[model samples]
Target: MAWHKKPKTNLTKLRIVRMIVQIIMFFLLNLVFFEIGANWLVLPINMPQTIFSSSEGSFFLLQRMLSRAIIPLIPLASFLIIGGIFGRLFCAWGCPFGLFQDIIGLITSWVKKYEPTHSTNNSMRQIGELITGGTLLISTFIGISVGLGNQADVEAAFGSFFEQPWAVLSPAVFLFTAIPVIVYWGVLGELFRIENLGSIDILLWIRLAIFIGAIIMIIYIPRGWCRWICPVGIIMGRLGEHSLIGVGRNITKCNHCGICEDVCPMGVQILSHPAERVRSVHCTNCLDCIPACDEDAMELKIL
Candidate 1:
């Protein structure tokens, strides 16, 4: 007796669900402001500020020292614990910046009639790794030495820098601060009859350049910033090595089609390895692979 082949799963449906969830989360975090009972249960995680906060906390602790100042632990700890359990799902499913990139990427793909290739160049990936690793190392060293040291003059010189270095130019800053300011000054100012909107500075130009560059890169390379330069994603990726949850494969069912690898925006070699689960630091737990697999071989598992 001949057996019939099982129908392929329509992963597009799952992707739609994820997209809706991402949209709701983005708006909720950016728009909603409320409290629960006596506790402020939900609050927008300021993406740029949180990146600096996490780095500072990790640096001080790693140096076998404690910060005299009260460093906010919620964002740092949340990234660690959540990443350790679910990998970089937050980057895939929650980051406003990530959402923005994905939207643009989809549009680019539609217009170009093809999906942009994920950066698979070994040298490029290495450069990305170095950038993220170097940022952490250098930041930690400076933070521990100059910011925390007893040299008052030195500390004062680097104090503000430590507070937020590249953060002012982050995409989050552009989306949250720059856009709003531009609208208020450029558009609303005319209606309000407020002539003194403020002068553009060098820093503003730098930020605009960065923002525009990021957009162009995202259009050409899927998840360009997260894959190549996001220090926050790099940190979460390191923690994800020991994540309790990951996408696993049923080896027997896999046809070795390489579709999963193709769909992966991070260019993970999902089929090249014999490991039962995808542990690639780049895996965002986006589950794009699940839908890409026509053989029904992949599933998320607790491991």
Candidate 2:
């Protein structure tokens, strides 16, 4: 009798290379973003204070390319023309926020017994998108108002209940970094904090509430905050819809086994009427589905 050899499944070196690229890019972009926030922790630059706020000088780096004496049509043209032509591979492969969500999802996965699911109704996602869109629009208005030397509502809003709300609600600085450290120090132990944790400029009660809420959401939902409420995600979702880089599906190689659907962290229906397409605006483009597919049907492409 011939003995059947069991196949060995090892993570490919290519996957390792991709992981390294992802990690390096994640840290590098974040370092850039942080450095732009302040200069040497002493002097500040004229650049935007935060990435997502309507602060004094915030600008999407890519969006700045729109207006040029020679290439006046390039910016908006690229934003609209590039994304639909390609899939949203940049979001999956390069976005730092996506990387953070992936890490948090992994941490929560170990403790989670069952997969968390949610309603995929477009209404919910639309509402989220609108809130995000409105915030950005309002921020831009504030920026113009400030630039024009008008500061009435801005000052009033800051002094009213919002009170440095940007610091407390910012997903970039507070959600991923500040809240976790504070929680670990205050509740779980000193394990997460390795040194003298910097004092947060937020009220203790507000900080405590955010910490508790984050813990509850992580356990109950996979990337709940990012998927449902993050203003950054909302903006990215819009950009991803027409991103120049994206996942291309070859229908000839696909068998529609629904495996990709199960693997998607955002719960997008992969085997649906889109027919060789997954234009899911809610998609973070994380590439979790590519490895899960039995057939070599999906590939990252530049359109």
Candidate 3:
């Protein structure tokens, strides 16, 4: 007559550490008040801002560079190097967008997070792939046009979208630049004074719509944009699939309870990875699974 007892997950310490890191990185990535001259040093993150943000995330720069007929060597290199070494860990530790989503998840903790089946989830991830491919194609088209001296024609057609199509629709731009610009310029107050709703920019309304949709997605599905929408995430996930640093399992302690997958924001099937390396492409190295495993089965392994 013996009974087995499961260990409880200790989310407190890891959450505190992650929150501190996210906050510090947000400020460093921002620094809107100062011209730090760090734009040249693009990191493989999806921070995504232009005017106010001094730091450039690799994907943002990629879109901009390609659209301008520039070969984005630096941004591509940053993605390869960082994604190779850290396996998208920056998303967990540094991305401001990730911080926002995590905060939303926290606020809506009382609501049960939506959990899609594996096949369904995999299909949903294709949305990001399509977006990445489509964005790159559009940028490539603009680049070729610019390189061929047809910039005027292209600009006449696409206008601002010819410069940076994705950023025009980016939710992060709304969060980081649009909102601040609105406040700083007193545009909202002026609009309210006149009550001129039609005067609002169409792009602003579109961005606001997208931003609200993103917030709602994260609240319901937790990291929904990261999982199913972000073009940058698709690239990072592909690189991170075979990354050096990752979580591994201690088979001796593991009872295969499947708790690790429950808490994963990216919906990775943790147990499916090799015992010594849980190298799932979607893993941001959040390490939330490590604490969730009551059996103490998971460990951060680096090679």
Candidate number with greatest lDDT: 3
Q: Write the per-residue lDDT of candidate 3 for residues 1-303, one digit (tens) a residue.
A: 011123243766787889999998887776765766455558877666556576888888898899889999999999999989888898899888889889998889889788777676778989889988988899999999999999899889988688768878888767777777888888777864656768777877777889999998888888888888887778998899878888999999999988788767788898888888887767899998898887889999987
- Checking candidate 2 for backbone clashes, the offending pairs are 83-242, 83-243, 84-242, 87-245, 87-246, 88-246, 89-245
- Which candidate leads the pack in TM-score? 3
Q: All predictions: root-mean-square deviation over Cα?
A: 6.2, 8.3, 2.9
For 1-303, candidate 2 gives per-residue lDDT tens digits of 111121113223333555677677554444544544321211010122343222221123211221111222432343344344533344445545545555765567657533444454355566557655654455555555545665666646644222223334434445545555556558535533546245533454465676567556655666565566654455556767666665657788988776666766677766663544566666766666676666877666554
- Give TM per candidate: 0.75, 0.63, 0.92
Which of 1 and 2 is the better model by TM-score?
1
Clashing pairs in 1: none
Candidate 2 yields a Cα-based lDDT of 0.49
For candidate 3, the clash count comes to 0
The lDDT of each candidate is: 0.62, 0.49, 0.82
Order candidates by lDDT, high to low.
3, 1, 2
Q: Which stretches of candidate 2 lie above 4 Å from their native place?
A: 1-19, 30-90, 113-118, 121-123, 144-148, 160-167, 175-204
Candidate 1 local lDDT, 1-303, one digit each (tens): 111122135666777777898888665554322321221222222253221122222322322221222343654666677777887887788776788888988788745422433345344556557755654454555555554554465447655344444455567667765676668568545533545435545676677788899888888778877776666667677777678988878998998877777767777788765558888777888888886787889888788
Candidates 1 and 2 compared by lDDT, better number? 1
